[model samples]
Target: MVPASTSDPVPAPSPRPQQEDRDRSSRRRQRSAVILSAACWVSVVAAVVVFLGSGKPAQVTDVAGAITAAGIVTGLVGTDLLLLMLVLAARIPWVDRTFGPDVTMNLHRRLGKPAVYLILGHGALLTVGYSLRDGLSLWHQTLSIYSGGDMLLALLGSCLLVLVVVTSLVAVRRALAYEAWHAIHLVSYAAILVALPHQFSAGRVLAETSPQGVYWICLHIFAFGSIAWFRVAAPLFATDAHQLRVARVETLGPDVFSIHLSGRDLSRLHVRGGQYAIWRFWSRGTWWHAHPISFSAVPTDTGIRVTVRASGAGTRRLAGLRPGTRVSFAGPYGVFTAATRTAPRLAIVAGGIGITPVRALLEDRDLGPGETTVILRATDRSHAFLWDEVRALVRAQGGTVIEMLGGRAAGAPSWMSAAAAHGQATIHSLLPDLHASDLFVCGPAAWTRLVVHDARAAGLPDGRIHVENFTG
Candidate 1:
C-alpha cells in the first residue's frame, strides 16, 4: 500500500448536519425514481386497459383476429415506450438532479431498441393478420395497405425508428462521427409526429372522439413540452443571459488543456464541483460539436474552468480556440459531488484525466481537515497532470494523497499499477476506513468498474460508492 502524506492528522468535527443532509438527498432521489418508474408502468398498463375496454379483445374469433388483437396491443405499448423514451432524453431538471445525465442517457439507450422492436412487431403482425383475413398474400396486403390512408406515413415512421436503433448499435455507432449520429437521432421527433396520425385516425381505440385519445394527446404534449423547454429553451436562455466567452486556455499537459470562461454573474449557474455542462464553443473551427465536460474548478463571481483532453477531432479543435470565443452551454449537471456524501470521512479514487472533477471537489470550502483520503492513479508521471494540485489541496486540508503510478498489470485486478498488483494491493488495503467513508471513484469505465467491484466486495454499501466514468 502507498503511504499517506499528512502534515497533521486531527479529528474531524461532528458530522450530524452532513449526515442529515445526505439522508434528505437520498430520500429525494429514491422518491423521484419511484414516482417516475411507476408513472411509466402505469402508462403502459393504461394503454392495455384502453385497448381491452374498447371491446377489441372480445372481437377475436379466429387466428387472424388473434394476430390483429396482438398487433393492437403491441402498438399501444410501443407508443407509450416511445413517449417515455422522449421524456427521459428531455433532460428535465428533476430527473437530472436525481439520477444525473449519464444515468438518464443510459436509460434512454436501453429503451430505444425494445421500443423499436415492439413497433416493428405491431406492423408485421397487422400485415399478416389482415392479409390472412382477406385471403391475400402478405406482399399484396402490404401494397394495398400502404396505397391508402395513413399507412404510408406509418411505414416511413417505422423505417426511421429502425434506422435510429440500427445506428445506435455499438459497432455502427463507433464507426460514425458524433455529429452525424446526433443528427440522425433527432430524426426520431419526426418519426413520432408522422406516426401519430394513424394512431388517432386509423386506430379504433384512440379515435379522435375517444377518451383514450385525449390521454394520448396529453402524453404527447407532456413529452414534447419537456424536451422543448428543458433541452432547448432553457439552454438558449441561459446562454443569452450569461454571455459566456473564452477568457484563456492553459495547457496542463501534452494534449490536456483547461478552458477558463468569463461570464456575467457566473455564480448564478449554481454549479457544484463534480457536475458537468454541455458546452458548444462558438468558434469557426468548433461550433458544430457540443461537449459534455466537467468543471475543473469551482465557479467564482464571473468565471469558471473546464479541462479537456484532446482525444478526438472535436476536442483537438478546442485547443486552438482563441480568447473571446463565445460559449453556450446546457447545464451544471450531475450528482457526483460533496452533496452526495453519506459519511464523515471520504475516500476518493481518481485515475488519469478523471482527476479534473476530483480536483474541483477537493477545492470545496466545506471540506474539513483530515476528512479525506485521495488515491490518484496514472500509467506514468507524465499522465498525472493534476497530481501536484491535488496534493496541495489535500495537504492543506490535513488529508492524505496516495499516488499509484506505473503501467497497469496485464492480468487480474488490472486497475492497479503492476507493482501494486504484484504486492497484492486492493481497495480495502488502500483505503483502510473505506467502509466508514463515501468512496467516490472516477476514471476510465473498465477501470472504474473494477475499483467499484473491489469496494463492493470489501462490503461497503452500494449507496456509499459514487462513480463517474471519463469515457467522454
Candidate 2:
C-alpha cells in the first residue's frame, strides 16, 4: 500500500485497452441491434412486395388501402426500432458508469440519428403512397380517413416524431433551457400512445386477412406492453410519490455537505457502494429536474446518504437545503463496485468531493485484507472534506490514507517518496512492491486520468483499474 506524494507527478492512465474493450463491446451490441432491426424490416417489406406483386389485381377502392399498407409496414419497423431505443436508454446508465457519461451520450446521439431517419422514411412513405393512390392533396388524404380513427392517430404520431426530432437535435436542445427541453421530451409517451392503435388496426401482416396475422399481432402487443411497463411504469412505481426527506445535513468542510435522507413510505433503494442517484429537491420550484450525486455512505437501517460539494447550481441548491426538505431520488445507478473486479492490492484515488464514493468503498465490510490505499488530492488539506473521517475509517479498516496538500510540500514527504520507491510495502510503511495492484479512482476527470495513467504505466493491467465519474 504505497502512499503517493502530492508532488510526484503521475502519468495519465493508458486508455488503449479500456477504450478498446468498450469500443468492441459497443460495436458488437450495435451490430446485433442493427442486424435484428434490418432483418425485421426486410421481412416486412418482402411480405408487402409479395402481396402487391401477387396475381391479385390492384384495387383502387379508396385511400385507406394504400395508407393501411404503408402504415402497416412502417409501424412494424418503427415500433421495433423505438423499442430498441428504449432498451438502449435503460442499459445506458450502466455503460455510463463504466465508460463515463460523455461516451454514453455520444453513443446515444449516434444511435438516435438512425432512428430519426427511419421514422422520417416511415412518414414519407406513408404520405407518398396514400397521396398517389387518392389523387388528392396530402392533407386532404389524411383528413379523409379521420373518421376511421387511424388518421387521428397518425397525426398524433407525426407530432410525436416531430418532438423527438426537435428534442434530439443537439443544437435545438442546447438552445432551449434544459427544463423546457425535458418537458417537451416527455410528450414522447403521448406520441407512442397515439401511434399504437392506428398501427394495430392498419398493419398488413398483422391484419385478419394474413395467415400469421394473429400471431404477429399478439407478439407485437406483448412486446409493446412489456416495453411500456419496464421503461416507464416500473420506474414511476419503484419509488413512492412521497418524496424523501433530509434526515440530517452535516457540513464536512467549507463547501462540502453530507445529506442524509429518509422517508417512511419510501421503498428500499438497492444500490452498490460506488453508485449515484439523481436527486430532486421537491421543495424547489423546479422539482422535475434531478442532478446526479455520488453516495458517500452506504445504505443503512435509517436511509441513504449522499455527500455533495457545492460545485454548480444543482449542488448549490442542495447545499442550502435544511433538514426535513423533501426530495425525490431517481436512481442508485452505475456498475462500479468492489465486487466487480479482483486484485491482490487495491489503490483508491479521489479528488475534492469525489471522495464520497471512495469513502463508501473503503467502508464496505466485504473488502477484506486486500492491502488498500486511499489518496485524496485537494487544493489544501483544509479543503479536503471528511478528511479526518476518511482517515479514521481507513485506519479502522486497516487501510492507509495519503492526503496530498496542493501547495509545495516539504520535499515530497518521506513516507510518500518511500511508498513510491518500493511499491509493495505494508499499510504501515511506504514502499514500491505495489505494482500489479488493482486501482480504483473517483475524482475530477483530469485527476482520474492522471492516476490511472500512472498506475497503468507502473505495470497495472487495464482490468486492474476502475474509475467512476462524479462530474457527469
Candidate 3:
C-alpha cells in the first residue's frame, strides 16, 4: 500500500497474460449474474403454472363468479412479485459481486413500482369482483373484505406498503432525513407479516400439500435467511474480527481528508481497489450514519485508508472524529477494479473527489510502462486535488496524463473544456487506443454519464467501460 501523502514513483506492472486471464474470470461472473436474475423470473413463472395446473378456479357458472376467479389469479401473481423483490434486496454477497452493488440496487429500484402496482391492482379488482357476486355496492364489498378473517390486518399491510413506496419516490426521499426515511421503510417487514395470515386463510391454492404453498414457504424462508446471514450476521462477525479503529486523520485539501485505520489482519477483508464500504464510526454525532467511502490507498497487513469529502452532515461529522474511534464497514462492494478489465491497456478519467478510488486503482498493482493512461478532470486548477501525487505515479509507469480544466466545451455536452474539445481532446484523442483499452470513470452522476456517452460514440464496447457514480 502507498502512504497517505506521497509523490513517490510507482514500479512496473505484471504480465499481460495474467490480466487477460482475470478478464475471462470477470466474463464468467457476468454469465452467473444473468443466470441468477433469470432464475428469479423463472420462479414467478412456475407459480403461474401451479395455479393453472392445479384446477383451482371456478367453472364460470356466471359473470360475477368469473370476475371473482380472475381476481384470485391476480392476487397470486402480485404476491409472488413482492416476494421476489424481497429476495433481490437481501444484499446477498454473490449477487452483489455478480451484478455490482449499483446494478443490483438499480434493479431493486425498477422492481419497486411494478410490484406495488400489481399489489394495488390485486386489491381493487378483488373488491369489484366480489361486489358483483354478492349483489353489494363496491363500498360494501370493501367493507365486507375488512370484516372477514385477518382481512383488516391485510388491508392495513397494503396501505403501509403503499406509504413505503411513496416515501421511496425520488422527490419524497430527497426531502426526508436518511434516518427518518429508513425508519419508515423498516415498516415493510410488519406489512409482510400482517399480509401473510390472509394468504393462508383465503387460499384454495395454498393448502399445505399444494405446490404453490410449498414453494412460497420455502421462498420466504430463503429470502429472510439470506438477509440474516449476509446482511446482519456477517457484518457483526467481521466487525469483531477486525476490531478496527481510527489511527490517524489528515486533511488533504479544502473539505477533503484521509482517515487512516488500524486493525487486526486488515487485508483478509478482501477489499479491492475502486470498491467502496459503508462506514459507521462508533462516536457521538457520527455513529448513526453510515457513509459509503472508497479506499484511498490499498489495504496493508495492519491498516487501511479512506478519503472522504464533507458533502453532508454525516460526512462533516466524520472530519471531526478522533483517533481510536471504533469503526465497522459493510462492503468492499463494486466491480470497478482491474479484475473487470477486458484489455491490456488501461485509461482512467476522474472528476474531483472521484479521484479517491481511481488513485487506489492505480496503486492496486504494478503497471507496465505505456500500459496505462489518465485524464484528470477539474473545474479549475485549484480544484485539482492530488494531481501532484498522481503525476509522479504516472511518470514512474511511463503512462500519459491529460489535465482537462473547466466546464463543458462551449457549453456543449462534452466532458472536456471548449479548447480541448475543439482540438484533439475527445475520448479518442486522449486514449489513442480507445477501443482496445479498459476505460474506468468515476464522478458525479451527470458528468460520468456524459463521459460514458462519449466512450460509446467512440465505439468502446459495453464490457470495456467501467463506471462508478457517488449517488446511490
| Highest TM-score model number | 1
Tell me the number of clashing residue pairs for each predicted model.
0, 15, 3
**lDDT, candidates in the order shown:** 0.87, 0.61, 0.80
C-alpha TM-scores of all predictions: 0.95, 0.67, 0.91
Error of 3 at 187 (Å): 3.0
Per-candidate RMSD, Å: 1.9, 8.6, 4.1
Better of 2 and 3 by lDDT: 3
Best by lDDT: 1
- Please provide, for model 1 over 1-472, each residue's C-alpha lDDT reduced to its tens digit, 9 standing for 90 to 100: 4434445455764666767887887787789889977887899999898777766699899999999889988988999999999999998878888777878889988989889999999999999999989999999998998886787899999999999999999999999998999999999989998987787667743465566777788888999999999999999999999999999999988899999999998889888889899999999979999999999999998999999988898999999999999999999888899887778889999999999999998887466767788989888888888788888998887887888888877756568888887787777887877878999999889989999988988899988999999874
Candidate 3, residues 352-414, lDDT tens digits: the string is: 888889988888867777778888888887668778777777778788777777766565677
Once superposed on the true structure, which residue ranges of model 3 sit more than 4 Å away at CA? 1-15, 58-60, 204-207, 407-410, 422-424
lDDT of 3: 0.80
Could you give me the TM-score of model 1 versus the true structure? 0.95
The positional error of residue 65 in candidate 1, measured at the CA in angstroms, is 3.1
Model 2, residue 434: C-alpha shift (Å): 7.6
